[model samples]
Target chain A: MLDSKQMITIKGTKDGLTLFIDDHSSFEAILDELSDKLSEYKPKKDEPVVPVTVKLGDRYLNDRQKKQLNELISAKNCFTIHAFDSNVVHRDEALTWKEESEIRVVNRIVRSGQVLEYVGDLLLVGDVNPGGKVITTGNIFIMGNLLGIAHAGVNGDRDAVIAASYMKPNQLRIADYISRAPDYDSEGVYMECGLIDKEQDKIVIDRLQVLSRKRKDISGFERRMLNG
Target chain B: MGEAIVITSGKGGVGKTTTTANIGTALALMEKKVCLIDTDIGLRNLDVIMGLENRIIYDIVDVIEQRCKLKQALIKDKRFDYLSLLPAAQTSDKAAVTKDGMETIVSELKQEYDYIIIDCPAGIEQGFQNAVTGADKAIVITTPEKSSVRDADRIVGLLENESIDPPKLVINRIRNHMMKNGDMLDIDDIIQILSIDLIGIVVDDDEVIKASNNGEPIALQGNSKASIAYRNIARRMLGETVPLQSLEDEKGMFYKVKKFFGMRT
Candidate 1:
């Protein structure tokens, strides 16, 4: 009952092109159409570089679909994937993040005896008191002090990260990795972030600036696209 | 008209009764007519703490039941001129008092007194409900320990839910050396956890214990640091902004001598 154009549509963006895929179609059928469309938009050697936004609406691509997309993108170096976003975030039963994730932001201080549990990521702009708790299915970002317990990626997603202005929390959990309070003083130290490194299989707490390397890598791409 | 206030804490042994007695006496010393009410009916201690035990002939339950006049139940403070106590009945239970009855009694006293301070029992039971029923404001007491702070947080939430103004906190029994050494929580830590305005902070002093044992309020002591804290709290309650006193400069030769013997700092 569906038309070919309706299943997958690509439009020119300000700096690039955006591909809007109808999430109602089967993954296999959509991926098949997406490849054909990408080939059509393939830029010539002398053509300008254009960033590509793949908006899947509420659905995210599965592992096999992602692999196929990667191969197709590698074969053609014309398109740059700017953002890949979906509306739905999935959580596992045992405190871990799966292939899906969402975000919730709270601006008020979490007082003692208060407990906040979100299904995906949580970004807070206030402090968490000693007896307070913030539990999330994905990463946690605390703009203020985090003196209480924080459990991120509760369903087994090892890639979850937690960052805070004051990261001297009573306890921190990322996926199945749990770390108790480390001997860290809060004098002059303003920023801290934590992540569960898969290779080390242990949680790592580092200066928040460590994330700048990753962010700068992406920013460099934008600069290169603008110049080259 | 008088303002009624309740001193409460969710956990036991956090010094609600002592705070009520000291604050009431301190206010009375400042030429304010204060009436101390004990709402912990079956388990009364304000009378004993104030040393007005023998004078309590007609208890709060007696006045509520109309067995005696309200004036007859109020025991005048023996030493403090402008202070009085409405003692609770040892034989009665918290169910004997109703919210409406307490409101009426407080209103009646408001006509003659400048302040009526209620000493609420420890816990969130009927006693706490009865005590806080007539209060226009509340002062929550807590120690620096984890359990006390946790309970105070819960009580503050309940007070907000009941539409009681966000209660000001009083962190009692803070040992400064321990706080500096990271063994105990400091005032800043407590304030962060409770997330409420701080009314006062009393230091851990032996005078507080001695004064309680003698039924004498530490606020009556001229040189005690705890007394200074209580006086500031009373003045602040009267709409005056009093700056918190720092204990560092006061730690002189006496503190060094005490610390030399490895006395519990």
Candidate 2:
């Protein structure tokens, strides 16, 4: 048994229009009705007709069908198409967006076979365990232990810095230059490594002087001891 | 609840499928509810390895497409009482399942099973993405060869991006003799470069090939070297602190005698 009295609704959106077909109605008849409507409404030379969605009861068109419709609409070169399973709001901006700030992974432990890489600044909040690697096109900051390999300035930025809390990496690199950590253990010495001279530098076990914010209440002798 | 663990390597013929089959069967033998999801799609082989090819009436695509429920597509393992398989679709391509689809399927399966092992397809593409979408952890399989290790490194990189923590490594088809003679890179070399915890090491065994050909994983065979390695891995995955077996233990008496004579073993 077929129902010819069933109604189908078609509406236009920013990108295209949605076509709603009753589940009991014939798909071919619905297409005929749409064509008849298009013939009567004949769009302008620049304006195009696109089918963004086709809903038949609860079973909407699948991705394959949506892509097919998108292709057909693009062939006409009039309007864009965006399809979904349910009602979708029209958006003026492009659906895809590129973020300015790169992805950051903090305090992350990269275990064996685990890699942490990003296109922007990659700040590790924890250790890059042995068997773990961190690669980045920008600067790499490891706030904790860095016993793993790390490659910074992957895009040939020589100014990129590879800083770590412990500053002991099995392998470390900045731009094209590579350096290995001191295999032999050292005593409680804080180190910060970066380019100080014209060439790439690795300052292992070298402490950076911290500028003390002194108070006026401190005496000269006490201030000398504190500053020293 | 079952945790989806994808055994992946970016390179081909690096023993990804072999590792998946062994780990899946080993976990099942340990009385844990397990399911092996073959995300290879058109190149499905987990079914063949598990010997459930003849039992597959519904493929994963059918379930994802809503032609059938998830249960109707699962093929129970004949060897293990608690094991089941969710075979990938052969007729359809890898595009049949999205990352969201995989996440949804794994979430549903996690409630019923103890371990969900995904046999990922080789290469870092859509198939790889689909396999790892819902993985709570990852097991990367690689051989002793340099190229295999390189690809495994990239796979490790991929798992890290997916926010999957503590990816385990299984060095497959290792030849201890070559390693001892310094002709090949040892475990220490790989550990130094890759910097991950070693879960297990499988020696080069003829039994694995024979068992795979017969559609049976060597893990089901007791007393075999590969089976022991698989069991050790299962133990480690269960939070057991099992030490890696020494390579000297695998050497025969004749080799040890030769070593005593300052000769190459």
Candidate 3:
């Protein structure tokens, strides 16, 4: 029978702990093993920091998927993850976490003088009137007209986009960049979206089909610093 | 117990007082005992609109302060046998009206009347709060303007938080031609914004102005199309399903000519 340590190894280093998760097993199974092993494996009694180095041994994960694994490690509240390493090549298809995100739906016209705020992707079935505002940390999906102010990537995520059926918006903001409606596109051509472009310099408004590709590239995983 | 229905339009001058007088008189005409309370306090208007201003001897302040009995404070409207008016104090401010006092008065009135229609004051301050204190339901009035719709939306949020049921919307002063021309907000636009059950839709008519100036509610007159609309609203409030009259009746010059020629539309 294989030993538990061989399946998922944990070693002590001068600075922190080094965790090696076996690649043969599924990520879920690996996570279960890691969680179980980490919870049971306590460090030296007086250790101040719980710095950890995770080696996936040739597995591919985008920033978001890596962030998920990092979150699981942080949930233990015993370690500070320094690095997430895998030898496998990062593929566009390997991006995960979009499936895990919450998509909030509201079926009401966001009227003037009203403010609608959400953390997840907001799907509104109504129009945003001229003095109304919609804000979200994730993407904004409006089934009705976007005639008001909409701010996406409120958490400084350049990837977040605002998509609407009628995109004749008064103002739009993506991450830190802000732009007003141009006179020519006073009435937007078709179903459109506003997103931060490749240069990360400004927000670009385009047909939704062309814009959604940028969304699929990043998915919905957010990466943040892990606290011990 | 009688239900307290507050007629409120968050912004000023959208016809909350006028609607109250009409609905109260209409309800009374239907043989239902109804009382109209001018909870506007210092800024009283219900008494004037109901033409019961001269009959107000003991006002709401006097009843609250024990200077007069609740019965004495109520002015019986001679126009309708079952209709009465609780006039607001011409002198005292909204601070004189307490939630507990209003609640007591409403509970007492509930014993004798079928409906208590409160004419809420403009703005969401003490006057508005005092009017809404004992309301069982709400009727939010709004003009088809951006500001009116905005204020109505805020009031709807407040009512959903405080009132028993989601407040019913009454879109007043809608201009059909402007709506068709895409110049003004329509009933659907206002409803879409407020997202509340629409109780009534009142079109802009000269009759409403004449009715108010004459101290008569259009509903009680039973003459003009506006009066019929108001009566239908009252009937609907009594739990009767009245189909809304569509605005497509007069489309353009061609339709008007046909109607003028007495041809079937």
Candidate 4:
């Protein structure tokens, strides 16, 4: 009989307790060991409920397995699940992430009553006239003037941003929040960027330089330039 | 075959009928056979503008419904021997003329006329669609106002989806002093938004209204600034390179004295 303690290990950290499961064991064996070990363990008297993080190293767990593991952890009265950490992700999830990070380049004017929509980030090379709209699930970057409507982070990604050379849009939306241009004429001579201010829960326009600090992972070339 | 051009402005009261009348008359003055088709059906105005409302024995609907021959529906202009007007029906609605009916009528007119100018009604509904269906080319007219320019942009966008040639722009009703004082939108600004080839610019003149009221197109007068502008537009349509007419007012002797004294007028 192999030692059961080698399949699962627990360590105390500043935040809470971390449970590491061995990838070499079969999923059924891991489940059996987890249930046996958690049930046999006794909590110290008056010891408050400790948050636990389960780290699955190189292990893939589908929804059903994850649910079973979560149920087993919850049955233990002394511990609460803080998070689930995994080294591997499903192909579909990785594909969605890759798509969200990609930038699509388009070169055409978006005229009035026209709509240009994209799944990922959009990089438009021409102007967006009044009554025109550009919608995207990710960020939007316009090389020409933006005198129309722009909706970024359309899929509820609050971190998405909108940047334009001449940002005089009629209306701007980031995630679920909507904002309109001020009544006074604000003809921006320089490029500008718009993002959601989480503190105020409002869409705020800022200088283009703010994008560099906010979106550090936007482009590898920019990062290389900064590092050099 | 004649080139069919639809003169359209998405908004109402921006001088669409007047433009159609003047362009048709100007082409006639150039000695070219021109036919003007009014597509505003229930709200017909092109005939009134051309001063031919009394001679309407048959209308476009009658010709389309085969109630009369095409020649019988054409009302000859009193001033121009080569110009004719096909009035819209005041009794029927815009839906009375289908797209196929319009195409047939315009194609028949094209075989005889040198230029067929269609005066499209306002808005992007059936009337606008019926007007543009038979045309080979489009001309979008707009004033310097924000609303007019925005609507013109929408019309230009819609026209792009059609098989016709790229639509040209005409900025109508430009006031010189207001433009100079930065009160109205500049010509450059309107062009920037619409982003289409500009065919011509028409200066706002009271003479246009007066000529329309008298049932005579301003282009036939050959004296007013509006008349000259319309003539230039017509010449441009005939493939002539006509320079844009200056919008500056004629300087008087008092204005010249002010310039000599280095004083603002």
Candidate 5:
């Protein structure tokens, strides 16, 4: 007799919008609330935000609930919905609802014969075993082992990356590129993956060295990591 | 309290029913109250194996659909008072019972017996789902052959997704002499690949075929190599830690010399 409650919270970012849902709330109620808030931000002539961002709660959402959430977001023009469990991955990016999409999945173990698909970036704080698969339209990050299949940018975003703590997946795919484990024994940094270079039209993978980028003003989870 | 264990193999013709018949009879002969439920609806054989088919007036579907009471459907064993058979209905389909329905029946049977063993149907369909629905534990049976092992792996995957914890493996129809001569896979290979807890190892015994023809389970006779293996499985289900009988002892120097002379073991 354990039922979950769904709560939806909306906050305006400097660029666009941010919608957040806390753990295990009524999904139907959250959708109704989201529809009401979305109508309020239709488009003011003064607004300059590109695409909106919505953050989802970290918990098990059944297939029906997930499909319903996806349909609701897609109805809005150029909007992105991010889902994550706070208990799993602690996000740190700072922006008004106008920026990056976030999605978090906190499962104990992704069992065999179960196919888990997400439209945005996925952060898994659990293991993906032999028969299970994680398919995402954006980047995928696994805090635990990736022993099964992990496909990122499933919709053909070549820049998407698949990172995990223990990357021993049976198969790895990003965008349209695919890679299986090499026949020879090999090991490098903990996070290893298959990625594509658009300019070269070639797929290559090695150790994930830290990328250099301009540091942006950070707050919340990102700010905590920057300081630490 | 008897454990409700389901013997499931995702592939057909891999000896699940045979294993169930032997294990149930073995447990009964050990003085444990046992009821074997054939959940294969439309193709029930537990009654035939137990030689109670002629006496079967009521079946599991009758009891479940409320056409009859539980006691009326139970076929008492002639060999042992502790054993009974709940045969599946040959006319009904898998949809005749749901997972919840099976759970109710198992929970009720659990109160009256020391062990309730379910014989699951092949494939990952509704029948398989119903069989494991109310099981407290599961024993995935497989032969060392490739096709059987592949199906076993698939079943293991399904069980994990369903969150059935720590399922035990029972390797059946193993041929030790064939393994020594590089003709068959050894026990170590199967154990390493499946990566699950082992309960028993049943050897290929001619006595099993002989007993089946007579409509008597080898476990009741308690002399064939397969019967001892089934006894080990029953003990393991009872939470007894009994190591498998050494295959090496069974395949001693005499069998080795027979192999040297190019004789078929």
Candidate 6:
């Protein structure tokens, strides 16, 4: 091979110093280069402790290797670790994130005194009868009538929404805000959605069509499909 | 084996005991050997409804606690030779009876009787659980009122989780005038909300309370509308296909004549 390529490159910006480690290099070689580069590096006297961010390009690091890397960086007294940024994640962590973000579908009558709950978004295909409850951490989409209580964003996600085909629910909750149905019977002929109004700091019921504007991220796949 | 049916309403004073007494009596009139168990314990009323409170020497508690044999505690009905009442213990609380205990008692009674009707106590507590534990089928009773229908829905939900067959519904205390005036819930509305099969509907008749006060079930009467409704329910329970009685039957001949002349009653 020609001259050995640099495995570790350091750059400086307004925020702090950034170390970009070459992923194609062997781990031992990268570690040796990082040690050598850090040993020779010097900060200005006026700013002795420079915050450094380490970027591993498309490289996944296990806990032990991450610990070793942190120790090596911390050994340099002139540098402080800001964070370790990585482009790749372990399969298990990726799977958990996928699970938390995916929508869960359920088809059954949620009768009185029964509670249906999920960790992520919920899509219920049946009616939620009075005295029943449906809860989720993300969003709720009821294809049938929702006559009971529905709680979206149980873990405090304020942006979550609850949409129902017939929205005469006993109560609606989003994040920490709760609002009971009005005493008078609402004309439940049209579909409705409940969400948090940040300006008023209360839950508000709106037309279901507002969902497209309120939660634009939920329509990304549909938009892409339409574009194609 | 005889089928054990539990008559329950999640709310109080929805005529569970009355229905139990009437159905048991109607079944006995059909010549089937019937046993009625009062699971209300400290709040025993089935015996009084069946006019056998004075004859309750030994009770369900006595049978469950082994103080008396099952047959010894069963008080024979005064009207029917085959009808019997196992009154609940007036002194003991609901906690005295366990699910397994009720199961054992009901199964033991099932061996001899053609039908065992259990009167479940109100509220979803130990009393309700004990009453429902031994039943093979359930009849959830509700009125046309909102609160009663809500409670009945809860009872139906709880019953669905059990191993027994899906519970049937009986819309009791219906008022024809209130329904006509739109002041009360419609029978179709109640059935749609409860989402269960309607076995029968009993109109709001003063004769029901009068019969209960005299410790005579209305089903014993031959011509009363409430008695006919109870008999129809009993016949339906026996797998007979009896069409639901029309509310028009309660109207007078003059109302019918006015309707024939296109005049609003």
Interface RMSD of each: 1.9, 5.1, 2.7, 0.8, 3.5, 0.9
lDDT of 3 by residue, A1-228 (tens): 245546577888997888887877777777777677667767676656588898889777668868878888887566779887667654433332342255778998776667999875789998887768999877898998888899987878777888898887889988888989877734464588888777857888888788545665444444311110
Which candidate comes out best when scored by lDDT? Answer: 4
lDDT of 3 by residue, B49-139 (tens): 7777787799999999999999999999968679999999989867999888998999899999999999999998878888888889999
Error of 1 at B76 (Å): 3.0
lDDT: worst 10-residue window of model 1 chain B: B157-166
Q: How large an RMSD does model 3 have?
A: 9.8
For each candidate, report its DockQ versus the true two-chain complex.
0.29, 0.07, 0.21, 0.61, 0.15, 0.67
- Model 4, runs deviating above 4 Å: A1-38, A42-65, A75-91, A198-201, A220-228, B252-265
- Which run of 10 residues does model 5 chain B get worst, by summed lDDT? B185-194
lDDT of 5 by residue, B1-265 (tens): 6678899989898789889998998888779899999999999887888888899898888988999998898889988789999999999866888887788889889999999999999999899899989888889998988667667867887887564667899998888878898677677867654668888998888898888778899887756788888888888887888988767545779999999999999
TM-score winner, 3 or 4: 4
Give lDDT tens digits, candidate 1, residues B101-217. 898999999999999999999988888888888788999999999899988887886686575677998999888889899788788878876778999998888899899988888
- The lDDT values for all models are 0.81, 0.73, 0.81, 0.90, 0.76, 0.88
Whole-model alpha-carbon lDDT for candidate 1 = 0.81
Model 2 lDDT, residue A43, Cα: 56
Candidate 5: tens digits of C-alpha lDDT, residues A90-154: 23233321123455566555655667787666888877766568998767788777767899878
- The order by descending TM-score is 6, 4, 3, 1, 5, 2
TM-score of each: 0.66, 0.57, 0.72, 0.85, 0.64, 0.86
| CA displacement after TM-score superposition, residue B143 of candidate 3 (Å) | 1.6
Candidate 4 chain A has its poorest 10 consecutive residues by lDDT at: A219-228
Model 2, B1-265: lDDT tens digits are 7687888878988788888888888888889999889999899988888788899999999989999999999998887678999999999977889988899999999999999999999998999999989999998888887678777876776676786876888898888889888777788877654667789999988999899989898899987788888988998999989888655555678888999999975
| Model 2 chain A poorest 10 in a row by lDDT | A92-101
Question: lDDT (0-100) at residue A73 of candidate 4?
Answer: 87
User: What is the Cα-based lDDT of residue A76 in candidate 6?
Assistant: 54
lDDT of 1 by residue, A1-228 (tens): 357457877888696877787889887787677677666764667765567777889886766776676666546777667766566544442123222243567887776677888876788999877677898766789988888889887877566678898867888888888987857654423688888665787888888787776334223223322322
- Model 4, residue pairs in steric clash: none
DockQ of 3: 0.21
